[model samples]
Target chain A: MQRSLAARVAARTAALRLTNEKLYNEILERRKAERALRATERKYRGFFENSIEGAYQSTAEGQYLNVNPALARLYGYATTAEMMAAVGNIARDVYADPEMRLRFQEMIERDGKVRNLEYQVRQRTGEILWISESARVVRNRSGKIVCYEGTIRDITARKRAEDEAARLRQQMLQLQKMDAIGTLASGIAHDFNNILGGIMGYVELAQDDLPPGSGAESHLKEVWKAIHRAKQLVRQILAFSREAAPERRKVRLAMLVSEATRLLRATIPATVAIEEEILTETDEIIADPAQIHQVLVNLGTNASHAMSGRAGRLLLRLEHAAIGGKKPALKLSVRDTGHGIPPDILQRIFEPFFTTKGVHEGTGLGLSVVHGIVKSHGGEIRVESTPGAGTTFMIFLPLALEAPQ
Target chain B: MAHILVIEDDEHMRGSLAQTLERLGHRVTTAVDGKVGVASAAVAPPDLVITDLIMPEKEGLETIMELRQHQPSIRIIAMSGGGRLSNEDYLHLAKRFGAQFTLAKPFTRDELKAVLAQALAS
Candidate 1:
């Protein structure tokens, strides 16, 4: 009986030792698994920290759960801690357009991932940055979205390049307009020069044949004066065409108007009464004296023609005015008590070859040429009139001052 | 009285020029083109020749050059509408090739007469 009890004790001891050894081996295996998991997490953190592109992880509510250094720099912050502290709501501060964030959420929910989404983002410094993002939705085991993971790339340089290209297109259009004008001028000068030559030649030949102080000489003299007037018209055409240089000078507006009025009175019918009103002593203006005279004469002639076959008052007024607070200007107003311009026709008046006057009486280019001259001189002209009441034309020219050396 | 040849492509302008020259007490002949003018001049050389620069079949420059080669002393007056060859270089070229004077187109009748008279006297 003693030998059997000893054998049972020995077997029980062996069984207890075997159970302890099995437990120790199990603990070692678990520790090795934990170490491997920790190494994997450390590798992921290093990759996120050293990435050039912005890396971020956010909750479905747009709360930033984690952000890398690149993401903080992109948000105009010196450090990730400062960026996190300042921007609590990524939807409000980062997304320039709030709709973009909503769209991103919708895309992630529908596809479980969003790729290459472009948006304008506002940084901490209030500067706009163009960004493209590729993100994936982090979902729970139940398939509900919990967080978002994304990589961002700066695309501001690409956006600026597109804007610059658009500006260059506009500049090319302006250059084309100037080129067309140059071509037109060269064509017209050829034909006009021929007509003047014939007129001048005939006048000279007629003068030589008629002899001085003859009865025919007086009639010939009248024809010669007409030719001289035509010559002046040619000069104006050449100036308008930019083939001839305009003679520019400092002119007194009041004196110019008075002179024009006196000249008009001599040729105007007795039925047509002329009046003048000088309101400002500010008569100084820089312009071509002869060209301005032509403008005044054209306006006066137009007024006279409008009042033909009827008695009317032709009023010329001069005044001083300031424009844009930059410089003073001389304003000349020519008002006629004749038929006014129709509203529909008012816009068309400044267009070339658009005239209400009968053929041979008017070349629709008058107002168009006037507009061109005014634009070239950096001045402005306004026309105000009511149909049947009469028309008034006001011309504004910059006041002449001594140019800096 | 000097015999003058007027070469022009326009019939009306040629007729008018002929009338003016005849009125000036000179015998005048008209040709509507440079080739006809050249042939006419070659057949019967005139004391003076006035030619328009641009013409069909033959241009004025060629006519003047051919005429000059035939009769170097023949007084030549060139007229241009101030088109392609109106620049000083063209004028200089005309002078170099034996043209006595170059009158810009659309020149007054007086200017033409004066230039003609000067060319003839020289």
Candidate 2:
């Protein structure tokens, strides 16, 4: 009996030891699993906090639930908390065009995610930025969208670079076109002038042969007048095409402006009022006086035509301008109270042979000649027009350093 | 009346110039180009010469230089329809090359007469 009792005690002790070892091993395994889980969470959190790109989470109501530090600075905010507080309505406050938000939502709903969606967005400072976003919708068990998460990258620099390149290409094309036209105009001028000379010589001889007050003489006189008009047109073309350096002289710009204004008053309809204001203290510039006179006359003529025969006022003003740190320049502005240039035609106004006038009214070389003369003189010309109101042309010419000659 | 030589390449221009000079009470001789004009001038030595600048055989600048060297006292008038440069620019060059006066083609009768009178008076 004693031996049987001892064996039962030993077996019970072994069974208890075995149960304790199994329990301890289970506890150790659970602890290892908890540690690994904590490490994985920490790794993901580090990625989220330290990412260079902007990361964001927003609820379905366009309320930002969370935003990383990079996103705050991109939207011109001090901190992520400040950004979230200021941007309550993401569509209205953030998207440049609120409709873009709707489009984003629709696309994401259709495709479950969107990649590299580019758009313009408004910052807290009211400045604009181009941003590219990649986003996905977070859904619940029932497949209902609960929130949205995205990464955003600033793309404004790239957008500006692309725009600048396109503008440069356009400018190059325009210059090439002008060069070709100049070549063509000069080529034909020689033959055309010769032919015109021959015709004029014959007509004059015929007129001299006819008796005084004869009908034939009058008809030939009319033909001579027509030829004179043609001659003037050719001269304008030559002026535009000529690459010869101008005869520059140091002259007071005020004198030329006054002379051009006087001519303008005499030529344009008397009904259209002429207002002149010469406000510059120093008006001397080294330029070809004839070309400068032509510039003023052309600008004045263009202004008069803009009125289309309606009663209006043409204002010519010469003022002093201090342009940055460079040399002081004289500003000559020709303003008209008439129908303004439309936006579509404004960019092309300086191109040769571009005109809105009838065939008999204009040769379409006025502004182009003005442009050429200004460029040759190291000056700049700019135009500002409002569709219904009027137009103003501003010319900036560098003032001569020497005293009046 | 002054003796004049008119040199031009265009037939009508040459004819018309001769007629105008004759009407102005001057004896006129005509040539097709600068080469013919120089040969004619060397043969008879006219009192005055009106030459076109752009001609086939010889250009006006060279012809002006040759004639100026041949007879320093002879009066010369340069005319041009203009080529690559403007008529004014070419005419300015002609003046530099010893031509006494210059005319752009398609000039009026009055303009031609004025230059003619000026050249003769000086």
TM-score (chain B only), all candidates: 0.91, 0.97
Clash totals for all candidate models: 7, 0
Give every collision pair in model 1: A194-B106, A197-B106, A197-B107, A197-B108, A201-B108, A201-B109, A201-B110
User: What is the C-alpha lDDT profile of model 1 across A37-83, one tens digit per residue?
Assistant: 88888888988998999999999898898899999998899988888
| Candidates in order: C-alpha RMSD to true structure | 22.9, 16.2
- Look at candidate 2 and tell me the lDDT of residue A382: 92
Candidate 2: share of reference interface contacts reproduced: 0.49
Q: Quick one: best TM-score, which candidate? A: 2
Predicted model with the maximum DockQ: 2
- Would candidate 2 be rated incorrect, acceptable, medium or high by CAPRI criteria? acceptable
Best by lDDT: 2
Task: List residue ranges in candidate 1 displaced over 4 A.
Answer: A1-40, A58-63, A88-120, A130-143, A191-405, B1-105, B117-122
lDDT of 2 at A159: 92
For residues B1-122, write the lDDT of model 1, one tens digit per residue. 89999998855456667777888899999898889998999999999999876566776767888899889899999876543222233344456556889886555667777998899899
